[model samples]
Target: MKMDCIRTTAAGLAVTLALCSPLVAQTATETDNDRLDNAWSDIIEGEGQLLSPTQYAALNNLAFQAAAARVCDGEKLDSEAFGKAVADILVDTETELTDNEHMQRNAAVLISFGTRYGLFVAEANGDNEKDFCAVATKLKAEPGKVPLFLK
Candidate 1:
């Protein structure tokens, strides 16, 4: 009888946790995502130079992605696609500087920065262009979707 009660109690507890875990997990996920998003928003709202250490690496990821676009695109960099990417990642239009001159200048600065990083990626992958380009192509196929390599 004691063993039966213990089993029932354990099962009830498991069921309760299973039901409640999603709500708990969802809140945590949203909080973490919002934190990163707010950080990005703040960065975009002001001068874009990144100064502090950050747990979110997406800003740094721009360099690698930009480099991949530049080096792996072969004959010409897809400026349109890359520009869209830069805008999407680096600029928060709502918070971005309203002055046309400053906005353009900042955009240019980010492009130049990405180009520099592209050079770095290219230099580092001098012998690995084949593989790097392949990955870049895969990413381009599904802009926001998970890459096959990730799955």
Candidate 2:
């Protein structure tokens, strides 16, 4: 009886550890993603020169996602889609900027492009209220005037 009880306890411990392994891995991945996001945000918000190659790649990924998300009207984009977008942008022939204007200027460009291309849909209603949803509605209303790439 004693041996049986010990074996049962050991089996329970093994199952519990096995179940927790995936959760541990997931938590680590989430932490890494969050750290990357925060670092990227800080870099963009800073008032300085252009980002390094790695930084640029990360921000480019974020920008592409922001653009593609608008293109699909809030449809959930997978990581692979965002990665492809970033890769395409990286290989484009356009010159990269390395000034404080990189963030703001790029943001404006995306907004303008999206609006001009009718890729953006504003969430703002006719109320003219200055809120997030209101702004989104207004932009979407004049999809041709708002850029899906902008903030």
Candidate 3:
């Protein structure tokens, strides 16, 4: 009788663990996504206001230049490729900007930042681009749902 009881308890514990594991992983992924979203928002809001039209154009040129280089090298223009290319441009543009210009130079900067973060979050959540874009679009449309970090 005692052996049977022990077996039942063990089986129950195993079942509980199995059920909870996915939930725990999902929660962790969501938390990470939230963190990334917040970080991106902070960067944009803090630096995006001072960008001039010329600076924005410069940033676009930089991004396109990076993309061209990748194509020249025969690299696949996948999400990671574009993300890294934009990231490189963002860093360079930031350095070139004057100290008072604490802003992303162009729309590409904001879009690339969000794309990179969205790709990361989607991977973590085992989701696809469709799901990611849906969530993002919904969040963007809802006023005050997400901070006004991107233009």
lDDT of 1 at 138: 53
Model 3 ranges with Cα > 4 A deviation: 1-36, 48-50, 53-75, 78-126, 129-151
lDDT against true structure, model 2: 0.36
lDDT of 1 by residue, 15-48 (tens): 3223322322233344332223343333333433
In model 1, which regions exceed 4 Å deviation?
1-62, 73-78, 88-112, 141-151
Candidate 3: tens digits of C-alpha lDDT, residues 23-102 = 32244355443334454334334443233333333333333223323322332234564455445545554346664553
lDDT of 1 at 134: 58
Query: What TM-score does candidate 2 reach?
Result: 0.24
lDDT of each: 0.43, 0.36, 0.38
**Of the pair 2 and 3, which is ahead by lDDT?**
3
Query: Where is model 3 poorest over a 10-residue stretch in terms of lDDT?
Result: 142-151
Name the lDDT of candidate 3: 0.38
lDDT of 2 by residue, 14-60 (tens): 33223312322233354332223343233334323222333333343
| lDDT: the better of candidates 1 and 3 | 1
Query: What TM-scores do the predictions have?
Result: 0.36, 0.24, 0.22
Model 1: lDDT of residue 106: 60
